[model samples]
Target: MTDDDDLRTRLHRADPAADVPPTAPDRVSRLLEKTMTTTTAAPRRTTALRPTRLITLAAAAVVLIAALGTWFVLRPDNTPGAPVAAPTVTEITAPGIAAKCAEPTADRLTEAADLAFAGTVTTIDGRIVTLEVTNVFRGAPTDVVRVAQTGDISETMMGSGKFEVGRDYLVASSEGSMLTCGYSGEASSPGLAGLYDTAF
Candidate 1:
């Protein structure tokens, strides 16, 4: 036989055409058409948020609640229609302070003090005396001056008596407040120099 026939016989011996599935003419045409066809896909849409954003939103809510609570607890008497509390410090209401014997008069105080002035007691914070100087008859002073004292007017007593805030008084001071033995009293009283005309 010829070389072509010999090759065909060897190929048929390796694998036969009857082993392959036969394709119908209509199925072959449908497969070819589907492979060549072009189709458009619908665009995707989403409103879902990321996990980090959700956590941040929750934390902000917690902080806002905590701040509101703190303001409610710590705010000073801000509620409407509430009575205002007294601003003055509480005075020691022990039995009336005994009359200090011969509370010093003006001439004695003038002769005794290096720096004397007539001023209003703006505040007495513990042992520190804050005065609003109305008239500086002796010694250089500004409109306001602070003098140090050795005693607490509320709990303790001095020879000059307790200096009440908001009243006018004559002060006899040296380096510090040496308010003893007729050196300090009312500004308009006989205890001060300029306010009182008569000699002691």
Candidate 2:
């Protein structure tokens, strides 16, 4: 109606709620209501994965370790369960004229002939004569010679007999000079006869 009344109406119309002051209790009540609503709301579902993942990882590790152990145990050897190979026995025959002789020279022949001194007959068997030779040329022990003799003559000598362990005839010779000596009658270029010549 008047100027002052019009100013007052304009101010009230501009902000009617500005005249009202907010109380502390009203602000606190709003905050409490907001907190209650937030707390009551359904919580987002969280994945229960860490425990399961750890279990799965542990299982995989166990499986890997077990597989490796099994593989190692089952590994095969190059020659599995085979008997140990025996040493190769190489039969080395003696060398010289004894090898050229048709008849096999006895071991005794080498013992009897290899020495400078003559040997005595220790034992005589059919086609086999054992002699004990002394005064060995090369400090060789008294070796026994087993000669092969028949028809008033000695045949090819074979080898020396082992009359006693560690004791042998100094030399052995085959009669008729057809003596062949060797580990197993193996022939050599310079045979036992050559060896005899060198020794005597």
Candidate 3:
């Protein structure tokens, strides 16, 4: 026999399925179909999961967007408003009488003066003078005091002898009337503080 025929014979003897009967075409076709269905089925299922994962991600994104929108709409405002307080005012009217005065004594001040304080003049509108109370020497605490300047200031008052805006004064009052004749005057008046200290 030729070398090619000899090699074919050797290969055929060594083949593991050489003695097996040949498969029929119809059976082979069924096996091929089954194999195609089994191998391709796993890939089809895997491809379907991609769309499902995409849909899940889309749903999560929508929920996150909705939550953020709600927070923005319902957020609390932090704007500031006015915080200044209105001052409490105490009104006292000074007597307009120009009377013959006697020497002001601490004994008289203690007996007659019911309210005494140190204050700064804030405004003067016609015969009305407004003072912002600084320190209360006697009586209830007050933020402001208004006095009606009905007459000339006593010559005994220190500084200008009259109420002037932005200047501090020591004042004493009884029954809603300002005391004059050295009993109330500028804060820097000599002996005035000593008199107040002795009186109250």
TM for every model, in the order presented, reads 0.38, 0.21, 0.55
Model 2 Cα lDDT, one tens digit per residue, 33-105: 6664333221111111122322332333334233433422332212234222321111112223323434324
TM-score of 3: 0.55
What is the Cα-based lDDT of residue 21 in candidate 1? 85
User: How are the candidates ranked when ordered by TM-score, highest leading?
Assistant: 3, 1, 2
- Best-performing candidate as measured by TM-score: 3
Error of 2 at 130 (Å): 1.1
User: Predictions ranked by lDDT, top down?
Assistant: 3, 1, 2
Model 1 earns a TM-score of 0.38
61-118 per-residue lDDT for model 3 (tens digits): 3342344334223322121221114444778877755676788899999999888877
The alpha-carbon lDDT assigned to residue 132 of candidate 1 equals: 47
Q: Supply the TM-score for candidate 2.
A: 0.21
Candidate 1 vs candidate 3, lDDT winner:
3
Q: Candidate 1 at 176: error in angstroms?
A: 3.0
Q: What is the C-alpha lDDT of each candidate?
A: 0.44, 0.33, 0.65
Instruction: Report the Cα RMSD per candidate.
Output: 36.5, 42.4, 38.2
Off by over 4 Å in 1: 1-108, 152-160, 188-200
